[model samples]
Target: MGADHAERVAHRVSGARLVAVSDADAARAGDLAARFPGVRAVTDPLALVADDDVDAVVVASPGAAHEEQVLACLEAGKHVLCEKPLTMDGESSLRVVRAERAAGRPLVQLGFMRRFDPEYARLKAVLDSGRLGRMLLLHNTHRNKSVPDTFRSEMIVRDSLVHEVDVARFLFGEEITEVTVYSPAPTSAAAEGVVDPQVSVFRMQGGAVVTNEVFVTNQVGYEVRCEAVCERGSAMAGRPWADLYTTVAADDGEGLWGGGVPADFLGRFARAYDLELQAWADASRRGEVVGPTTWDGYAATVVCEAGMRSLTTGEPASVTLVDPGPAS
Candidate 1:
């Protein structure tokens, strides 16, 4: 993810330049830095944050390192674009939120790139324009071709399902009140004792319900789809592959017709990621932050924590978020 973001900033995004690269692996950082002219490689991330030439920072490091790096950026008065999870858990995420609040400005933007996807943006527009009346239900599907054996059941909730958690909030503008997760029998493709597919139901504060199917070992490529059902009508958005079917001649005199799916999320949402970074760069230039805020990150973490509990207990769990207080 860090390398991908580096490529975007150096080649695709405007108003930003790749000034430096850092990683625990010094050689890896050096190799990436060598690709961009005048870019330096730093071994320590905190040193990267304290660099004088770096006006703003992008935190694509491991989630465990996010709180310290983000807090360092805030203290240095630099804008930041941090990738998802915000931190490894909800408590650290809230601490980062408090640090941002103490800074007295919105300096951090969470990388919920789906919000910038063209189809999703159009769907959001349709829902908000009153054309759909009041949205009452959302159906989300998240699938992947495969994952490493190291990826566990809880990771499905934390890594894959977390995206849907934010989508529900982003589209409905309401907090999720509760979440219930149901894990069925594992598929042969899944690691032993791992949950390959998970079904999660979310109840929103506004009486709306969301259902999500998360299948990490679907063996059918990366596919994400969302449909919003409303009082008057419904709207759906999905991968462009959904519209690009092809026909092929076969020896049996029958034709095979189907569309191709992306091998990963990068292929599925490349444009969205570019636009997200561009928007972040543009906003940082103005000393402002845009897109998903720190609060969105914290909320998703809180909801995912509840989902993990449900995964264990096989029962619905109520979502809880600590009030950021009147100052927020």
Candidate 2:
């Protein structure tokens, strides 16, 4: 993700310059920096944040490193675009939110790129238009072909399902008040002791309901889909509406016709990432922050933390958010 963001800022996003790249591995950073003209490699992340030439930053580091690095960016008064979770837990995410509040301006934009995806944007527009009446439910499906051995059951909730949590909030225009996670039998491709598929039900403050099916070991393809069910109508994204309609002779009358899915999220959301980075860059150049804010990130983290607890206790958990006071 770090490499992907660097490439976007350097070659794609306008009004932004990839002045420096940082990694714990100096050689890796140097190699990546060598790909772009005048881009320097900074071995230490803190030094990268403190670099005199860096006016803004993109934090694609591991979630655990987010709090410190984001705090460093706030301390330096640089606008930052931090990837999902904001931090590993709600407490840490709240701290980052407080820091941003203390800065007296919005400087942190979260990397919830799906919000920038054209399909989702249109869906949001439809919901807001009142043509759908009132959105009552949202159904989301997040499936990956596979994952690393290190990816665990908890990560299924924290990382993959977290996207749907934000989607619910974005579409419903309310906080997720509760979460109930259900884990069925693990798929054959699942790692030992890891749940491959997790079903979560999110209750919104507006009395709307959202359901998410997160299956990381689907062994099919990377598919991210969402459907909004409103009082009068419905809309969906990532429905694989193919250009051709045909029935292959190999399948006889089985009626198997659908577009191919991407191998991973990077392929599916490439354009979204580009748009998101472009918007962030455009906003940062004006000394303003846009897109998903730190509070949104923190709220998602709080919901995910509750979902994790539900995974353990096999019960629904209530989402509790600490209000950041006025001026949030």
Candidate 3:
């Protein structure tokens, strides 16, 4: 994701230019810098953040490093686009939120790129139009072909389902108050000790409901789908309308359905990622944040922490979060 964001900023985004990038792997940073002329390579993330030539920051470091780097950027008075799990836990996320609040403006845009996706944008518009009446329930599913070997069962909530957590908050226009996670039987294809698929339910403060099923080893392909059940009507997102299924049937009329699914995250969210970077860069240039704010990132971390606790305790876990202040 760090590399992807760099590519977008260096080339795709209009007002953005990659001034410098850092990686724990110095060689990797050098390679990326080589790809983009005039972009410098910094061995340490802090050095990147402190670079005088850099106008803004993009926090894509690993989860543990996010808190320090993001806070440092805020302290440096640079706009940032921090990737998900602003920190591994809610406390650290709150620190970032507090820093943003103290700054008296939104300078951090949480990388909930789904919010920028065309389908998701349309869905949000539909919900906002009051045509949906009041949203009662939302059903979301995130499926992937597989995860890396290091992936564990807990990632079903903390990683995969976390996206839906943010989406619910974004679409419902409320905070998630509670979370409950239920694990079904693991499939044969699941990695050892890992629950390949899990369900997470969220209760919103506005009395809305959200359920997310995370399947990281569907052994099929990458796909994300969401549907909302509202008082007046329903809206769905992420379905590919350009699907073309070839028929292989015998004279007896027996047939098989076949089509392609997204091979990876980039395939599914290429446009969203691009648009998100463009929006982030444009907003940063204007000294404003027009995307998901730091508060949204903190809310997601709080919800994900509760979901992880519930995933193990097998009980509904309450979410506790600090208000990022109305003026923030």
Sliding window of 10 residues with minimal summed lDDT for model 2 = 242-251
- For model 3, the stretches where C-alpha displacement exceeds 4 angstroms are 240-255, 324-328
Instruction: Write the number of the candidate with greater TM-score, choosing between 2 and 3.
Output: 2
Tell me the tens digit of each residue's lDDT in model 1 across 141-241. Answer: 99999999999999999989999999999999989999999988889999999977999999999999999999999998999989999999998889444
Model 3 RMSD in angstroms: 2.1
What TM-score would candidate 2 get against the native? 0.96
lDDT against the true structure, per candidate, is 0.93, 0.91, 0.87
In the range 189-246, model 3's lDDT, one tens digit per residue, is: 8888887789888999998889888888888899898999999889999864445445
TM-score of each: 0.97, 0.96, 0.94
Q: What local lDDT score does residue 140 receive in model 2, on the 0 to 100 scale?
A: 97
- Segments of candidate 1 deviating more than 4 angstroms: 239-241, 326-328
Candidate order by TM-score, decreasing, is: 1, 2, 3
228 in model 3: Cα distance from truth in Å?
A: 0.6
Cα deviation at 63, candidate 2, in Å, is 0.3
| Candidate 2 per-residue lDDT over residues 6-109, each given as its tens digit | 99988998888889999888899999999999999998999999999999999999999999999999999999999997999999998888889988889999
> In terms of lDDT, which candidate is stronger, 1 or 2?
1
